[model samples]
Target: MKEKVLILGGTEFVGKLLVETLISDQSKELYLFNRGKTNPHLFPNINKIIGDRETDDIQKIQAHKWDYIIDFSSYYPASLQRTLDHVNRDLKKYIYISTISVYDFNKYDRASSIKEDFPIVDCSPEEAIDQTMKTYGKKKAACEAVLKESSWLNSVILRPSIIFGIDDPTDRFYYWLRKIKKETKAIVPNDGTDQISLTYANDLVAIILKGISGDIQNGAYNCITHDSISFNELLETIKKSTDSNCEFYHKDNEELRAQEVFLPLNFISNLYYNNDKIKEATNLSFTTYENAITAMVDHFEKEEWKKCMIEIDDEKLIS
Candidate 1:
């Protein structure tokens, strides 16, 4: 019998990629558990368990025994708790896609690169109750904590940095690609020395696949693929990938506010996370910045490199 793999949130970027990759694997049978609202028509032949996590609608989940549960949809501790209550105790592994925001950057010095064992954000029960953007990181931390307390669940928690690729909703990375292709003078932020770590969606999926078979270990792993890189370095990588003739200059915070400009990717000089643990564990090399950005360029090229639904007066900001 094929090993049963159930994925939660299988319609969007990373989840969609996982489903497509797993579909071809002969040793595993794939099933997706979601509300069936997003891209409802996608993967028509794959097994789908339609239900809402908020309402605890997981009867279908209880009916089946899962070999592996890849959870990309559980944003709340309660949602995860509900799923745990329904699923069987026996499983090879459970993989969860979490975020690096779970780490308390303020707790560390600016130069310290975060590690898997770094102190995670401490969340209170009252704070977790608020389901807003402000509580997102804290709530995710709570989710991981909840998983740790689950004595019967064998799990791997993957906390990735900003995930970038095709169908990217935030458009933080895509913005630079479009800016480079459209204009010659790229208005950068304060010398663009801020450090960041990005997880290419494809690379992330690659590690997820490795987790399925390799001598898998269970714990919270920082899933970032690359070392912390400078934002200016990132800008140049995008430029090289697209072969764009772009020049850049920096402007400080006050000037940016004067122009009413809001840039993406949280451009502040800070230490992102370390990826050495994940690399050693998965024995996987990540896609080069150019290759990853090239993928982005190709996907956006079909759309004629259109604005990613975010408006900015380039001329005004550059001036």
Candidate 2:
């Protein structure tokens, strides 16, 4: 029988991209679970389950026996525990969508390249249950530990850098772009020297699916492009791509830090990844940073990027 794959949080950014890729591969059956809202059209042809992970109505999830589960939405420790209990024990692979925030944010000054072995935040049991607010990274680190303890399945944990593309509503990078577009002088933090990691949506999805299909084992991997670009270079490239001649007032990292202007995009790394494993495993090369930023600018100019604009309803989650 073909492997049955279930994707939780199928409507969000990475989840939506994963569904698109899975549907194109005819060898597998795809199922999506969410709250029956958001970009519902993205998964028009797949089986869907509507359930809230927080509320614990696992009935929609318990009915199916999936060979692989791509859990893109598991955040809280309770959700992670619930997922382990609900999935079939015989599942071949359990892929978890995680973040680089699992690593220490303060360590960027020390290392140019952050490996998967980097230390993540520590969380207590109480912190895991209330995982929504400031304790997000701590909870995710705890959840990773939880899945690693499971002896039943081969768990693939992916720690991706700042993910940006057309459908991303987080406004992480777009805020800068919008500021550049509207103002005569764009203010950038840290003299644009602070190194940052960026991954295109398509590139991230490719890595996740390739890891799953190849039966990559229960270890963790950092998903990123081979190259690291400074924030100044990123903006310059975008301006060139868009033909915008706006002047940029560069501020050193210290100044930006002093002013506390949301200068740096979070979940950053110094362009770290030993893609040797992924290359040997799947021979997939990620999209280049310059090309990725250019593509993002094109999407913005074409207005195709608005798909990721966080709707007012969804904005409440972060606010």
Candidate 3:
């Protein structure tokens, strides 16, 4: 008997990698539930239900009893609630690809290490419906709230910090890669004190696979294993891995934005998580920063390079 698996968003980034990993396993039968808009041709042999999860179209998925429903698409609570109404939770395990953004920065006074038990940002009714990037964390918190309310849901929430890998449409991490590869001098965000945690795609997929194969406990777990990296350490890693000659200068994130310059990962507090829970549950290690950089460098192509070609007046910032 084949294990029925349905991926809510299977065409992009981490979700795409998840699909690829499952394809190798012959015991799992895969089904994709997406709008059929993104990279539709990526999976030809797999069964796909093309519909918007926000509307009644999501009902199409309820026809089958799935062994696992991996959701990467739910941003708001309403969407998740609607989808859950259609799910036969009697037999399926649910895995949510949540972000570490769910942690409220206001809860901390400085760079502090947080765990799954930490207080998440509260989502207002207005913020729940809005789709702007500003309300993203709150809305995700709202979705998590829905999961918490559903006491019967056999769900495992995996909150990952800044995800970095190949085929990443979001040019956050790739922005640094481009700067290191092309430019000589660049202005990095803030002083070198701010530390950030990142999750490599391969390691994240391994934890998700562990949940799928084994009986994972129902709760949220921070998916990153590495301790943390400071702002200077991040740039040095990128430079060392690529052997680039880029000179980095210091500038506050707000200062750069005031000059009409937008940089990625303008984080306020430290993103380090106490990952002892995940570490104890699964004996999985992570990709070293150097090796993860190599993977991204190897996969960066003409399109990705073209994305890096944005005209940023680094000289103005440097001066």
Candidate 4:
């Protein structure tokens, strides 16, 4: 019998890729639950359930038992709790796509890399409702807590760092790519020495499939590239991929902040993570940053160049 797979909020970004990956396998039955506000007609042959997780509409998801339920869009603790309450007993395994932001930088101060066991930001139930970027990490940590504490569910939490690929709405990674491709001069942060972690959306899909096949052990795994890259290296890779002669000028973080300009991939704290646990458990090979950049640049050049073009103001960089 084919395995029943239910994906919550599988209409965009990583969720969309996950849906596509699962549907490619004829041995798995795919079901998507979302608000249906995005690309609702993309997969006409598969099952689509329309409902809002924040409202009473979410009850539409509890009708059937699933072998695996991958949650791609549960950021708020309340919303996650509601979903868990409904599906805890009905699903055999739960996979939550979390972020490395959940790790508390302050607690791990002076540490070069973060592990799954690193301390996460502490937030109360009251504070988790804000849902802003400032509180995003704390909120995700809370959601992870909810899943772990649930008695009826066996869960796998994947903490990815800066997920990027085609159809990404955030434009965080694309911002630098576009800047390098269009401009001769680009402003970088902190002399471009800060280390950063990134994950290709397709690689994340592969890891999730491995988890579904019971090849990856259950627990929280830092889902990112096996190796982290410095910000300067990242810019060089983008420059090479775009084949652009972009000269990068390193500006102090304070200066950039004073100008009200924040560079993407430049984090306030070191964003490196140790992927030894995941590598040992899954033995999966991740895409190199250079290769991932080449893929992203190619995709943008072919399709997203026109639709997702971003204008960088030189005056803002100078001010």
Q: Specify the highest-TM-score model's number.
A: 1
Displacement of residue 302 (Cα, Å) in model 4 is: 1.4
Q: Which segments of candidate 1 are over 4 A away from where they belong?
A: 267-269
Cα displacement (angstroms), candidate 4, residue 314, comes to 2.7
Give the alpha carbon lDDT tens digit for every residue of 1-319 in model 4: 9988988888889889888778889889999988889887788999988888888777777787788988988889988988877773756689999998888887776656778888888878777899578888899999999988887778999998888888688788888888889888888888788877788898998888888887775689998864777888889989988999988887898977877776665664466688888888778888888888898888888875754344557545755
Point out the higher-scoring one by TM-score: 1 or 3.
Answer: 1
**Model 2 global lDDT (CA atoms, 0 to 1):** 0.72
The lDDT of each candidate is: 0.83, 0.72, 0.84, 0.82
> Model 2 misses residue 77 by how many Å?
1.8
- Give the candidate order by descending TM-score: 1, 3, 4, 2
C-alpha RMSD between model 1 and the true structure? 1.7
TM-score of each: 0.95, 0.86, 0.94, 0.93
**Preferred candidate (TM-score higher): 1 or 4:** 1
Model 4: runs farther than 4 Å from truth? 88-90, 307-310, 315-319
**Model 3 misplacement above 4 A:** 301-304, 309-311
Q: What tens digits encode model 2's per-residue C-alpha lDDT throughout 1-319?
A: 7778888887878788788778877789888878877876766768888888767766568898888888888788777887788888888888898877788766555545666777778988888878366887888898899898888778898877778876676887776665555445666555677667776788878887876686466788877655667777878877766667777766555544554544437335354554455455557777776777677777787774344242222122122
lDDT of 3 by residue, 1-319 (tens): 9999999999998889999999989999999999999998898988899999989999999999999989999998999999999899685689988888898877765555788898899999999999899999899888988998998888899998888888677777888888888789988778867888888888888888989986578899988757788878888988887789999888887877778787775564475688888877787777888888877876774345666534577887787
Which residue pairs in candidate 1 have backbone atoms (N, alpha carbon, C) closer than 3 angstroms, thus clashing? none
lDDT value for model 3: 0.84
